[model samples]
Target: MASVVWYVCLAGLLVAVSGQIVDDCVLVGGEKKSDVDVAILAKLAPLKNKRFEAKVEEGSDTYVYTFVVCGRVITNNTSTNEGLLQTKVNSKDSSVIGRINETHVISGSDWILLSYRGGDKYDSHCGSEPRTAMIMISCTKNTLADGFMVIKEERSKSTECFYLFEMDSSVACPPEESHLSAGSILLIVFAVLVALYLIGGFVYQRFVVGAKGMEQFPNITFWQEFGNLVADGCDFVCRSRPRSADTAYRGVGDDQLAEEPEERDDHLLPM
Candidate 1:
C-alpha cells in the first residue's frame, strides 16, 4: 500500500513540473483556454478560501509564512502582522499568458505559472522587491496528492516541485474548524452510551436473565420483587393505625381467624 502511494505521488509531481506555464494566463469574461496545462486551477477556484504554508529564509533566520489564497496578506502565523504584512495579491487566470525576461507569465489548459519579484518575505516591502521568484500550483487526481506547488525558479523541473498531501474529500481543503469538534463529538459518544445501556438492559431482561441458566434464581422475577417492595412500604406507612381487639396480629401483619363469632356471641361482642 505504501509503495502504491509513493508511485502515485511521484507521477503527480512529474505532471506538475511538466505543466509549468512558460507564458501568462488570464480571464477575460468567463471563458478559459490555457496554453499548456489541465483545468486544475479552474476547478479549484475555491482554493482562494484556503491557506497554504511554506518556510522561507531571510538572512540567517527562517520564518514560516502562510499564504492566504486570493489575498495579498502573508503572515508568519496567518495574520496581518506579528509586526508586518504582505501587500495586495496579484491574480491572473487561464485566459491570458505573458512571457518576458523580468517575469514569465503563462497560462495552459490546466496550469498557470508566474515568475515575478519580491513575494519572498513576510514584510510589507517584500512585495516591492525586484528579484525573480516563481509560484506554480497545479491540481492532480492522484490519491496520494491532490496537487503540488512550485516555489523555486519558473518552469521548475521535477526536482524542484513539492507535492501537497491529499485533500479532504468533503472539503476542498483542511478546514479552519475541526472536522469533528471535541464538544459535539463527546455529546454523540454520550448518546451512544445511553442507547447501549438501554439495549443491554432490555436484552438481559428478555433473554439472558430468563434463559435456562437462570433456573437457580427463579423466585427473583422483577415484578414479584417490585410487588413485595410496595407491600412493605404500605405496611410501614400504616404501622401506627389502630387495630381491633378481635383481630390477631403476628409478625406485624394481621391474621384473620377462619371461623367467625357465633350468632349469639356476635350479638354480645363490643365494637
Candidate 2:
C-alpha cells in the first residue's frame, strides 16, 4: 500500500511537470512582460482543455497532427513514441514522425514558441538528431475558427528535423488598459475622506472621550450643527418672501384722536 501511494505521487508529479506551460513557454520580455503573459493565458484558458488536429501534406507524406495550447495533447498512442505535440496518423505508418521538441525549450516574443527535445530520430532526409516538436502561438482579434494548423511536418532545407505548429487566437492580444477618469478619482477621494473622518471621529469619541451610544460619533455636535445650518440656508432661499410694511399695516385716522379728553381734564382741575 505504501508503495502504491508512492507510485501515485510520482505519477502526479510527472503529470504536473509535463503540463506546466509557464515553465515550458517563457515570456519574451521576462518580468515586465508577465502581465501580457497573464492576459494572454487568461484569454487562452478556453483552449486549455481543447485539443486541435489538422491534416496536411508534405512532399509525398500526409500526416494528421494533434496539439493544444498551454496544455498537453492526449490521444490513443499506437507507437511507443510520447509527446504533447505528435502526429496521430501518417501515411508512412511510422507511428510518430518524430518528437520535434522533446525538451520543451521556451522561445518566442509577442508570439510564443513551445519546443521540446528527446524522442525518436528522423530519417536521413532530415538528420540523425532526435525528433522534436515546436508549437508557435500567434494572437488575433478575429474569432478562432480553427485552433492550430500544421506549418511544416518535415524538416526544411534551412531548418532541422522538427515539426512546426502555429496557432492564431484572440488570447494573444494585449489587454486594454483601463484607467479612472478625473471625476471618478475625485469622487473616490471624497468618499474615502468622509469615511476616514467619521471612523476617526468615532474611535476618538468612543475610546479617548469615554463616550457611549450615539455620543461615540466623532464631531457629532459639529455635524448636527452643520446639518441644521444647511437646512436653514435652504429654507431661506426657497421660502416665500415677506410682505412689505406698507401693505401689512394701515395708517390711523385723525378723527379718532384723544385731544378733547386732555382739555376737559385741565378744565376740571382749574375748577
Candidate 3:
C-alpha cells in the first residue's frame, strides 16, 4: 500500500514538472525570433481587410519599433463577438515592445484600433538595420484565420528597417479569455489532491488502526487498575498478621513464657 502511494505521488510530481517544462518551453520559444509566425499568431483573433505597419528608429543603446495594426474580427454562423488585437515588438531581441488592451471587440462595423511602441537592446557589432522578426496573433473564434506577420528592412535601406502594411479579412476576434493558464490550474489542483490524500492516509493509519488494535487487548489503564487491586489485597493480609518482626519470622512458643523457681525462703530462719 505504501509503495503504491509513493508511486502515485511520484507520478503526479513528474506530470506536474512535465507540464511546467512544456509551458516554459512554449514561452521561451515564442520569445525567440526563430519561432514560427503562424504558431505564435494562432493565439490571437483573425483580421479581415486590415493592414499592419511597423516604424523603426535607433536610440542610444536600443532599437525602437512602433506597430499599428488595423483589422476587423470576422463572425459567421458559428461564432460571435470577434476581438481585434494589435501588438508591437522590438527587433534587436524579440521582447514584447508593447501590447494594446488584450480584447478589442470587433463588430462587423468596427475597425480594430491597435498601436504599440517597444524596443530592444542594440548589438554594437550588428548592422544599422535590425534583423528580420515575426509577430504572431491569435483569436478564439474558429472563423479567425492564423498567419505570419513579418517586419524587415528594404534591401537598399541602411538607416530604415522594413515597413508592413497588409490587410487580412478572414480573421475573427479571439474568444473571451482568462488570465490563468489551464495547465497551471491543473497542476495546482493535482498537487492539492495528492497532499490531502497523504494526510488522510496518515491520520487513518495513526489513529484508527492503533485504536482498533488496542480495543482487542489489555490497555495500560486496565493493567494499572489490576495492579492497584492486587496491592490492596496484599496490604490487608499483612495487617492481619502479628506485629513483632521476631514473631513474624519465628512462631511464639508457649513453654518459654512459664515462671522460674524461687530460691530465697531457706535463708530467713538462720538470721
Best by lDDT: 2
Q: Global lDDT of each model? A: 0.38, 0.57, 0.38
Per-residue CA lDDT of model 1 for 140-259, tens digit only, reads: 333322333223322233222221212222212211336788898999999999788766766665576664534323344775789999998998788876465455645543445456
Give per-residue CA lDDT, model 3, range 133-227, as digits (tens). Answer: 22334333443433434344343544433233222333334224577798999999999997887667556656766644444333446667898
Query: Residue 166 deviation, candidate 3, in Å?
Result: 6.0
Q: What root-mean-square deviation over C-alphas does model 2 reach?
A: 12.4
Best by TM-score: 2
Off by over 4 Å in 3: 1-115, 124-142, 151-271
**Per-candidate RMSD, Å:** 19.1, 12.4, 19.1
TM-score of decoy 3: 0.18
For 1-271, candidate 2 gives per-residue lDDT tens digits of 6534443454344435443444433343343333333333443445554667777765876667665454444445642324444453533453343332233333233455556456466555565666666777776667552567777756665437677777876644544556989999999999999999999988899889999999998878988999999999988899777444355556677876646754345656745
How much is 271 displaced in model 1, in angstroms? 99
TM-score of each: 0.25, 0.46, 0.18
Tell me the lDDT of model 1 at 117.
31
